[model samples]
Target: MKSLFLFFFLAVSAAIYAQSASTAIKPKPSYCNEPPEAYDSRKNASAVKPAALPKFNSKPVMEYRVQVAILRKTDPTKYPFHRSLVARYQPCEEVWIVESKQSFRNRQDAEKLRAELAKMGYGGAYITTLVGYE
Candidate 1:
């Protein structure tokens, strides 16, 4: 019968496929068998002492500033300033932060500058400390 012959062929094909799959070699990964030392972090600490870094106790006093606005780019023509006033342009994290003069060591000066900047069309301006060491 044709059905019996087809069933016999399928059974033989399945047996051969199963035999090939069972005989296939599987590689043993090394990470699966970690050593006992890998489990202990304290034991693997640095054997040698690290050298001491130079001291910086006598750092200079810090100052504050008024931040006008942050944009992709700044327009110097609109936000004009003299050399005495600091209009710092910091380009960081894919944007630009335009800082009003670093001349504001006190809150009063920062507030005054922020108000002036607002009148000049920079409404969202505010005061903040300098970003990092000079």
Candidate 2:
């Protein structure tokens, strides 16, 4: 009976020693191949200057409209036209575009106005689209 008790005590001691030795937390191994110099977060953030953003000078767009005339150098209003006419400066083409104030939803309406403008002695008047910036 005494020998059996000694055998049980030695078995319990071995098990307790094995569990305590294996419980220690160890550092995990890294698998990443990239260098850690680019990812360091300990540097001062304010010392690094951010890149400058590009300026948005204009937002040019093209749309269908009834073009009445194209003027250069002088103002568009100096020419003979109705009060509803609007002149838009096109920087891309470097010219002033004279068009009707009333926007047409479809191409047929713009063509009708263009025909009328042609009959009004504007022989060069035609329907065309131009990109302009405001």
Candidate 3:
């Protein structure tokens, strides 16, 4: 019975020693390849800087609204139709957009209005889509 207790104690001591010695925590490496960069983080220190992207001064685009219009012909200054709108500026200064009361949310409705205006003797009538800025 004494030898049996001694054997069990030795087996438990070996197991406890094996577990503590095998499971050692380690610190992660600073880089993967090449030398580290001073400006970059540890995870991306060895990464290469990409090329610069093209700078564009473009305005943000929103949902487009379809507009139907006809140029004023009677005095060129006065609206041909009482309900039609007039452009505020010339092309040299700013974009001249004359949106009439016949603006539509969809293309199909705008095309229908253009055809109706054409049949009504407004031969110069046309459809143009306008963004938020216009």
Candidate 4:
């Protein structure tokens, strides 16, 4: 009787241990079993499109000469001084005096120079593009 009881107890323990081990080992799904429809090429193509160029005005381009100046103040009191200086220096017929809140003498010369000045420490300089009418 003792031997039979021992044998049954060992058999139950082995069955429980085998069930726990199998539960710990998860089975991975086989790729071959997946449906062919899951790998669709149409889905990727629909997400992308060719970029378009922006439209611009085709009007005649006018070029203007520019002069850069550093004014002492913004009030009209400063205008006469600027006007006098501009009249004295007098840029060619195409050039005009442009007033700005900030001082950037070299940058006001051209668009590229203005952009470069903005990148450097002179972002406050007001930009004026001159277009010669005459």
lDDT of each: 0.62, 0.69, 0.54, 0.45
lDDT per residue (tens digit) for residues 48-68 in model 3:
775556767777443333333
lDDT of model 3 at position 56: 71
Instruction: Candidate 1: list runs displaced more than 4 Å.
Output: 1-46, 59-62, 73-92, 131-134
Candidate 4 residue runs with Cα over 4 Å from true position? 1-61, 64-70, 73-109
| Candidate maximizing lDDT | 2
- Candidates 3 and 4: which is better by lDDT? 3
Task: Give per-model TM-scores.
Answer: 0.46, 0.44, 0.35, 0.22
Q: Looking at candidate 1, what is the lDDT of residue 51?
A: 58
Candidate 3 wrongly placed segments (more than 4 Å)? 1-75, 82-87, 91-97
Writing each residue's lDDT as its tens digit, candidate 4 over 79-120 gives 443221232211222223443323333433455555554565
Error of 1 at 108 (Å): 1.2
Q: Order the candidates by lDDT, highest first — what do you get?
A: 2, 1, 3, 4
RMSD of 2: 30.8
**Alpha-carbon shift of residue 68 in model 2 (angstroms):** 1.7
lDDT over C-alpha atoms for residue 19 of model 2:
73
Q: How close is candidate 2 to the true structure, as a TM-score?
A: 0.44
The model with the greater TM-score, 3 or 4, is: 3
What digit string (tens of lDDT, one per residue) describes model 1 on residues 1-134? 99999999999999999977864434445654665553235565687655555776564545668776565433454655534344444332334456754655577877887787787776877777654443
